[model samples]
Target: MSSSSSMNKYWIPHLDIHKKVITQELQFYLGPEATVRSFTRDGEDGFLITTPGACLTDEQIDDICVKSKEMWEKQAAARAAGAATRVLKRPLHQPVVISKAGASESTRRRRESRRSNETRSRRDERRRN
Candidate 1:
């Protein structure tokens, strides 16, 4: 077997969900030395935990498995706790639709009022003069 292939068989790293791989966010969080071997969707919504691999002796691999499991369990617990916590949700406003509907109601009222007041004032000044 090729050296790389052999290395993969013993120390290959990958992560997949059923078949597709996970995002870079999960990979970086796993640390540089960890290689994501595969991932399985955790629930109906497709939450996932990626499996990782590393090059190690048999003993080291065993220790790593234990440590990795601990880390994952802690992370999962933290996630569950966070999810249970209440958070304020902000409303998103969609874009307003504009049309050639002339001026807005307020603007039109203001302009009409201003013009009427000016006309009345001009008439009163003429009468006084």
Candidate 2:
């Protein structure tokens, strides 16, 4: 028997058959809008960002491809712009203040006492060894 005998009119034509097969495969596996629905819908390129296996019409797929290309170009341009504005060199070290020149005496005494206690504990451990 001929393969076209039981096929529908849409399935008989080569172009239509291909589209229908793509549509069915996308729908069977990816649902609709096939891997192109996840993209932002704000511009002409939003449809290219869909999850993998999305089912969409041929026109929609074309639109997604076009938009994705545009987005890629824009992203490349932005990256180039940012790279142009960055500083290449950096200082090795930054100075840090140990203590304020005129801090309260009480706080300083408390910190010193805590440090002395820690030092004493370490010395006592060494003696035991």
Candidate 3:
């Protein structure tokens, strides 16, 4: 018997089917529990995007594919931007006082005193050793 038998054959082609697609797959599955209505409206709900199996027009389907791709690209770029901004080169907290002094007489005196004290401590340690 031919596959297009009267008993099982459909008079209208698959292209005739049209359905409104407003909700996303996440929203669809996240709705009520599985039922016969769910199967008739949306295809199998076994962890898949509900938009694919819907009987939308060819143009609508094509537009959906293009828009979905664009959206995915935008989302990827946003994620990369977020990650880049999140990373920091410097430490978490900044010091309250930077303590940078110009080459004044007091600064010169302090540097000389620090060096003399350091050398004296090192000489004493070396002599003891």
Query: Which digits, one per residue and each the tens of the lDDT, describe model 2 over residues 1-129?
Result: 224333222111121222323333434444443332223333422223233332345674454455556666777999999899866566445456676756657789889999999999999999999
TM-score of each: 0.31, 0.30, 0.31
* lDDT tens digits, residue span 1-129, model 1: 223433332222331222122333334444443344442333323333323344344554344455556666777999999889846474355455673355676787898999999999999999999
Each prediction's total of clashing residue pairs, residues at least 3 apart in sequence or on different chains, is: 8, 8, 0
Residue 116 CA error for candidate 1 (Å)?
Answer: 55
Tell me the whole-model lDDT of each prediction, alpha carbons only.
0.49, 0.48, 0.45
- Order of models, best lDDT first: 1, 2, 3
Q: Of 1 and 2, which scores higher on TM-score? A: 1
Provide the lDDT at 14 for model 2: 23
What ranges in model 1 sit over 4 Å off?
1-10, 13-55, 91-129
Error of 1 at 24 (Å): 17
Give, for candidate 3, the lowest lDDT window spanning 10 residues: 7-16
**Considering lDDT, which of the candidate structures 1 and 3 is the better prediction for this target?**
1
Residue pairs in collision within model 1: 14-36, 14-37, 14-38, 15-36, 15-37, 15-38, 16-38, 16-39
Error of 2 at 97 (Å): 30
